[model samples]
Every structure is written in structure tokens, then in C-alpha cells.
Target: MQLIFDTLTGNTRRFAHKVADLTGVEVVALADADPRAPYLLLTYTFGSGAVPESTAAFLGQHSHWLRGVVSSGSYHWGESFGRAGDVISAQYRVPYVARVNKSGNAEDVRRVADWLQTHAANAAD
Candidate 1:
């Protein structure tokens, strides 16, 4: 498994680290990723926190799982973060778990770890 990000202020980077720590997954910046990895944790802040331009472009050009939260900061208040994730999930046939934190509280990271673990276990089964 791999955790990929196009972080600016390290908020996304910190979240990626937490997911790696929990899952023992390797971390790679989007630019250095292996396109063939079966599982990918794509993290970015977007929409009010919208997705980074590079990350969005990458998603448009490549097919991968986009795990973790999708909103910038207002996801909890009936925002469209999950909506954006749904579009990607449908297009890629990849499952997405959407989370939001106005305070950068690591909720999305934790949820991503949990989602990855579940997928890993299911794959083994």
C-alpha cells in the first residue's frame, strides 16, 4: 500500500504520516509514486480546502483509490467534499471514505487507516 500526497503546508503530510504509522504502509509523494500499486491512499485538502491542482490533474490522468478526507475545512457542515469523492469513486470504481476536520484534528487520517485495514483484510480473505 502507498500513501500519496501533494501537500503545501504539511497538514496533509502530517495526516499521511499518521496513516502510515497505523497501517505500516509506505509513504510517497505523488510525483514519485508507482502507478501499478494495487492500493493507494491519495490525500489532499480541497474545496474551501479544494484539491490541489496537481493532485486533481493526476486523478484526471490516472486511476487510483482516493482514501481519506476530501473537504478543506467545512466538510462537517453539510459540505460537498463527500460529493466530490463520490464522483471519483464512481469513475475509478475505487471505494472512498470521506472525512472532514475544521481543526485538522486527524480524524480523516484515522478513518483512512481504518478503511485501508478493512480493505487489506478483505483482500486476504
Candidate 2:
């Protein structure tokens, strides 16, 4: 799977890169991501549970190939934490793979990697 990320503070990018390293998935920026290929989107949620404009626009154009979504947000947001993942997952009918705080930890990477690997193995069959 490919890792497509959109970030302003680089937290999402860092998490995406970690997941890419763990899963051996190729990571790319939202703009550089291939729309024709299936990928997992890693993005940051901003104020009021809103997705970044860039990520939304990318999804607007390329969501057909979207496989899943992972969102990064501050835990301080409470109920709003990572809500963008929910919206995007519902919007595209893709899995909400994970909600990571800030840059995420090793366990976050492992969780996402495991989820992707499960689907990857299933797809191969």
C-alpha cells in the first residue's frame, strides 16, 4: 500500500513515514500521490474537526482509489479528536484505520501496519 500524507506541522508526515518504514509502503505527499493507485491517507485534523483544505481537495479528486484513512490530532480536542478520520472514512466508505495523537508512537505505527498487512494479504488471495 502507498502512504499519502498531508501536513502543516509535519506530525502527520512523520507518522506516515514511520508507518511506511514499518510496513515497507512507499510514502508520498498528497500532491505527488498517484490518483490511480490505491493508498492509505494520513492527514491532520485542524480546529473543529475539519480536515485540511489540501487533503479534502486531494480526496475530492482521487478518493476513488482511497483504501483507508488515519488522522492525527491533539488529544486535548476531546470528542473532536481525529474527527476528520470519521468524516473521510464515512465519505469514502473506507476504514478509519487509526487516530493518532501528535506524531504518534511506535504502537500506532504497528497498529496501522498490522491493519494494512491484513488487508494486503487478503487482497493477494
Candidate 3:
């Protein structure tokens, strides 16, 4: 599976690259992705739990190959923190892989890496 991502403050991008480094999965920006291959989306949540308009637009046209989602946000948002993952996961019928705090800690990377490793074969199909 590909690692597709969108970022504003670069936290999501950093996280995506870290995961890619561990798993050797290809990583691409939302604008650059082909979306013909299965991918896990990594993105940042915008205002009050809203999905970035770019992400929503990308999904609008090419959600068919989406396999899962991960989102980045501060914990301060409480219920709204990383809610983009929830929204995308529900709308696309894919797993909500993770919610990372900012760029995420090493443990967070490890957990997401493990999940990606576990699901790699499934996404290939």
C-alpha cells in the first residue's frame, strides 16, 4: 500500500516519512498521488475537527483505493482532536489507523508501523 498524505504545519508529513522509513512503503503528497493503488491517508485536522478542503477534494475524486486513515492534531482539542480520521474513516469505510499528537513520538510511530505491517498484505489485495 502507498502512504498518501496532506500537511499544513508539516507534522503529518514528518509522521508519514517516519512510517515510510520503517516500512519502506512509498510516500506521496495528496496532490502527487495517483490514487490507483491502495493507500493509507495521513493528514492534519483543520478548524474544529474539520477535514482540510484539499483532503476532502482528493477523496471526492479518488477515494476508491483508500485503505485507512491517520490524523494529526493537538490533544487540546479534546473531542475534536484528530476527528478528521473519524470523519474520513466513516465516510470511506476504512480503518482509522491512528491519531498522532503533532509529529508524534517514537512509540506512536512504532504502533502505526506495526499496524501497517500487519495490514500490508490485506491492502495489497
Candidate 4:
């Protein structure tokens, strides 16, 4: 699957690039993505479980191609951490594929990579 990221502090972008490298998939910024191509969104949460406005805006016109979402956020938010991902998943009817803290760890990458393998294979069918 294609990867697209919406980043503010670069964490999401870095994570997306890492995933792209691991999966050998192409990645683009949300602003630069092809609206018609299917992709899994990588983004970070905003205040109190809010989706980033940039991601929301991009979804406004291109959500037809959105397949899943991965999110990054601070753990300090407790139960609210990564909650924006929940919102997006529910709103878009896509899977909430992964959640990471800050830039993510090796385990996070593994989890996402594993998911991509299975998810993509399922899609191909």
C-alpha cells in the first residue's frame, strides 16, 4: 500500500519514511499525494484527541482512497493518547492500524510492518 504522512514535528514523517523503507513502498506528504491512489495515512493527534486539521482537510476530498491510519502521540495523554486515530478510524470506516509514541521504537516498526504484510495481502484478494 502507498504511504502518506501529515507531520508537524517530523516524527510522523520519519516514521512514514521508515515504514516505506521497510516495506519498499513509496511515501508522500499528504499535500503531495495523489488523491485517487489508495493509501494508509500516517499522522499525529492534536489537542484532546483531535485529528490534525491538515489530515482532516485532505480527507475531505480524497477519503475515497483512504484505507487505514497509523497515529503518533505523546503517552502523557493517558487514555486519550492516539485517540485521534480512533476518531479517524470510526469516521472513515478504516482500520486503526497502529499507534506509536513520539517517533516510535523498533517494536512499533515491527508491528506496523507485520500489519502491512497481512493487510496488503488481504487487499490483493
Clashes of each: 5, 0, 0, 0
TM-score of each: 0.68, 0.94, 0.96, 0.93
When summed lDDT is taken over every stretch of 10 residues in candidate 2, the lowest stretch is 116-125
TM-score winner, 1 or 3: 3
Ranked by lDDT, the better of candidates 2 and 4 is 2
lDDT of 4 by residue, 47-100 (tens): 888999999988888898888899999999998898889999999999998888
User: Model 2 reaches what TM-score against the true structure?
Assistant: 0.94
Every candidate's lDDT: 0.58, 0.89, 0.91, 0.87
Tell me the tens digit of each residue's lDDT in model 3 across 1-125. 89999998899999999998888989999989888778889999999999999999999998989888999999999999999999999998998888899999898889889888888878756
The candidates, ranked best first by lDDT, are 3, 2, 4, 1
In model 1, which range of ten residues has the least summed lDDT?
64-73
RMSD of each: 3.6, 1.6, 0.9, 1.5
lDDT string, candidate 2, 50-75, tens digits: 98899999998888778899999999
- Candidate 4 collision pairs: none
Best candidate (score: TM-score) = 3
TM-score of 3: 0.96
Report the poorest 10 consecutive residues by lDDT, candidate 4. Answer: 116-125
